[model samples]
Target: MKNVIKTIGIWLYILGCLVVGSVFAQDVHFTQYTATPVYVNPAMSGFHGSNYRAGANFRTQWNAVSTGNTYRTFNMFADFALGKPTYYSNYAGIGINFYSDQAGDLNYSTNKVDLNVAYHFILDNKGTNSISAGIQSGFGMRSIDLTNAVFANQGGGFDPLGGETINRERYAMFDVGMGFLWSYSPNKDRSYYLGTAMHHLNQPELSQFTSIGVSDRMYAKFSVIGGMQVPVGERMHLQPSFIVNRQGPSTEINLSTLVSYSFNREPFDKNSIAFGMMYRGPLDAIALLTRVNLETLAIGFSYDVNISSLSSASRSNGGPEISLVYVGKPKNRGSERYCIPF
Candidate 1:
């Protein structure tokens, strides 16, 4: 009886999510938003003050809920600057981003590829202030495996012979997004930036039951992100950041702060360690994050502890994520430095 109840509960939760997705909007989420810069905003591509940047991220969640009921996502990006920076100058950037996600026992999955471009306008003679405008175009595919799904009409138990019909299992769509950013930096050691983005401007159709005359369109998503870096001492720095996101009737906000200690005096040499904590508003979850910088490469890891109303079902286990980033400078411009590791 206990096993039956647990199975039923899991099914109910999955059903609720599917219903919400069809009626409202659904998008994949990540705890380490800063690590996946292009996903947060197209204007962030190549914003690291380097000649080129490459990054990858992976996340897995709900592993403790049930076997074969987990969710996973993978993302990768590469971006480069078009021109070298002088005291005051304009520049352009281009990038490519790809990501894939899979969730639930039904094997629902999404894959996307995007191309982005941005133009930067120098606002100060010292090149300390700038604005960036960017746009992105992408194609996405969503699929599901209905053969593994369990329906209420299948009785209270599993039965392979239960007959059910699902007309379609996959769909494809085109997507577009745009963003703007404003950055201020007195020098390399201290900086502040703010940006906003709008995604899914086309409201692409996502319904898999097209044969049944059901049409579902994905809602547009809007986001705002901001962060500031402060130098606490010669070797220590503090950074506070926040992100607000809204799609359809759902909304989320995340706040985080990080403290970094550099082992070397040279800012471009890249030898540092940082630790931070993040909170998802309205008691969603608490996360602990850490990063290590070595030369031109940096690696980060974070774990989330569930604290929401669903914690009882999740057993307080949320998710874990890992990220890797590489920032490279041209030989001619080796003296340039970035204000933050992420």
Candidate 2:
């Protein structure tokens, strides 16, 4: 019975691929710049401070597009500095993240896990130039639940090479990645970061069909992020940021600017709020900004009002998005350590 179930599952996986290849629809992605971090690059694992962090994101695109095609993802990571050049200059840390995405009944879905480790090196006495190298390994599973999907055509009506209706099946696969990060800062507490990462270096086979097909040949991506605080007056400051992403034949860019203020309270508390717009070119079009925040705690949301030609049919409800982030450490709060850089 176990073997029979496995065989059925394999067949379902193949069917899912066929459906996916035929649909050729794009995913509903979020406009929030920080949610899809790891998908952008593995080096992002250590991009934050020497602390652990975690996040999740979900997108519903083309409301007019079938609900089955909506996209959802969840991610989490942890990093920390190690050694002691002066005080933990020999920085090192490890992180893990997971994500699952599905589109339409073509049943194209991926559940992946990543393990990463990185080390930071100081290249100058000025503390402005630093470099980090990181490696990542992980496995993924893809499958289709054909039993619940609504096929384009009734299966009973078809006959030819194979049966019209296939059940559900899943496959487990593995991949590896490596990345490099270069960072610099002209002043204290401000940074400019650049990184590159290559995913699917292992190029694992994903086909469960008799003919054996393959996944995307490979994914090479590059990213650049920079931010600085500008004095706006006595108690207010402005921060601007930009992020660019590329994968295989697709590319995207995100731009944002945030303004913040500081209080004269003890420990010098600080607060900030940011809003910016994004132009995803022909793919996605909209502007978004985040809500205000207190030190170590941040909450923000974004919405993408589609302006594409499809807008006419989508009721101007193209796609809406929301994101929430919390960063901070618990004081005298047990043995758990969090990466909440305020």
Using lDDT as the measure, the top candidate is 1
Q: List, residue by residue over 174-293, the lDDT tens digit for candidate 1.
A: 999999998888875788889999999999987654554566789899999999878889988887898988888778889988888888854432798888999986788899988888
lDDT of 2 by residue, 104-223 (tens): 544567787888877767577655567778888988787765555432233544222233323225768777887777766544334456666666676665443533433433344445
lDDT per model vs. reference: 0.79, 0.54
List clashing residue pairs in candidate 2: 9-169, 69-104, 275-289, 328-340
Q: Where is the poorest 10-residue window by lDDT in model 1?
A: 159-168
Badly placed stretches (over 4 Å) of model 1 are: 1-24, 155-165, 266-269, 334-341
Residue 133 CA displacement from its true place in model 1, Å: 0.5
TM-score of 1: 0.89
Error of 2 at 192 (Å): 2.1
Overall local distance difference test of candidate 1: 0.79
Give the Cα RMSD of candidate 2: 6.7
